[model samples]
Target: MELWPASLAEITPDLYATEEVESEDKEVVAKFFALGSSLTWYVVEAQKLEFGDVLFFGYVHTGDWNSEWGYFTLKELEQQRYLGGIPRIERDLHFEKKRFGELDLEQ
Candidate 1:
């Protein structure tokens, strides 16, 4: 699907942008083995990130949906993927609320 970020962010001016997240904004990606719904994560070296650190260049979900793009360690992600077995990424990131909605928009 095609997304028009410019229209939404520019019209609102205060919502579209990249911000450095804190510890709570980080996401965890992992590979898991599932047997009929029973899942087990792969914590081996292959699950590690490729770079020392990773930051997602994505937007967060809000307004009834509590979700964020989340940060990760790239080197670790790539390393883990190279392990050879079936591996995937899993992360538990958080969502935030907007506090500037109260501002009056200039028509």
Candidate 2:
């Protein structure tokens, strides 16, 4: 994984215990974004990660989850091109060629 190039700090238990805790962290949450966009990109707050916590993130061209262009495992992030999610896009041309390849060679 790229490690997001960000860090998380420890929050005080007392501050997080109050009913207003969520409100207090509103600004902090707003500033936390996994990916940077051309319009709004900045290094903001840090996120506290715990053991066994699943760090699930998807790489998207337009930030559209439904329009998934690819998928990626955390392992792939170490490579430069694999920084973003892997593309699962279906190309009609490629699919057709693949299907053709599956046919009997004699034909």
Candidate 3:
């Protein structure tokens, strides 16, 4: 198994290349334990930008977390209705449409 960065945003290309090699050789590595599945992964970490806080990227299996699987902002997470408001579960209806082409509800 080999790990390599798939892309570079701009600021550091050489750093990404070097990191890719380290990641592959296991010198530098990352692991994610969330949503139940243990995943070996990497993250760019949070960066402060001119507009606001920015987080690069990371990935884990869908089964790791029971998320509806879509893009979301931290603000949205804070505003989610589950602990109070409209309920995040309802939001999955949209994902059902996007992923399965329809909301079966039965699943």
Candidate 4:
């Protein structure tokens, strides 16, 4: 995913503790977004993984707990900390006939 060019180098850090101390965590998490009109796009998911934790986040964001916006994952999160920050971007990955994993991380 494309993080806002202005975002910090380690835009996202220590999303949370791992299975060593896990729970069905859910909260209003801020991720570096490259699209739309904000430095970060507030999305929801089962988890917002950072570092080498390769896994897909879940859907369902909510103030009162009810606003499913689909899931996002972290592949290059660890490989390139400089480009991560945004989890589960929705830049036409579904409508553009493209897969989320199709995004280039070689930059």
Instruction: Give the number of the best model, judged by lDDT.
Output: 4
Which RMSD does model 2 reach against the true structure?
18.4
Model 2, span 3-97: residue lDDT tens:
33222223212122323423223222111122333111111122234542213222123334332212232223323232364432221221111
Give the poorly placed runs of model 3, Cα more than 4 Å off. Answer: 1-42, 64-107
lDDT (tens digit, per residue) of candidate 4 on 21-79: 22233332334333433222232223333553433342333323353444454443323
User: Which of the predicted structures, 3 or 4, would earn the higher lDDT when compared with the native?
Assistant: 4
- Candidate with better lDDT, 1 vs 2: 1
Q: Residue 24: error of model 3 in Å? A: 5.3
lDDT, residue 60, model 1: 30
The sequence of per-residue lDDT tens digits that candidate 1 reaches over residues 1-107 is: 11112222233222123234342432212222222332222111111124434323332333234433433233433344324653343332221223323211121
lDDT of each: 0.28, 0.25, 0.28, 0.33
Record all residue pairs in model 3 with backbone atoms less than 3 Å apart, i.e. clashing.
Answer: 35-64
Q: List the lowest-lDDT window of 10 residues for candidate 3.
A: 90-99
- Per-residue lDDT of candidate 3, residues 7-59 (tens digit): 22233222234334322232212222222233222323223334442333332
Each model's TM-score, in the order given? 0.21, 0.21, 0.27, 0.25
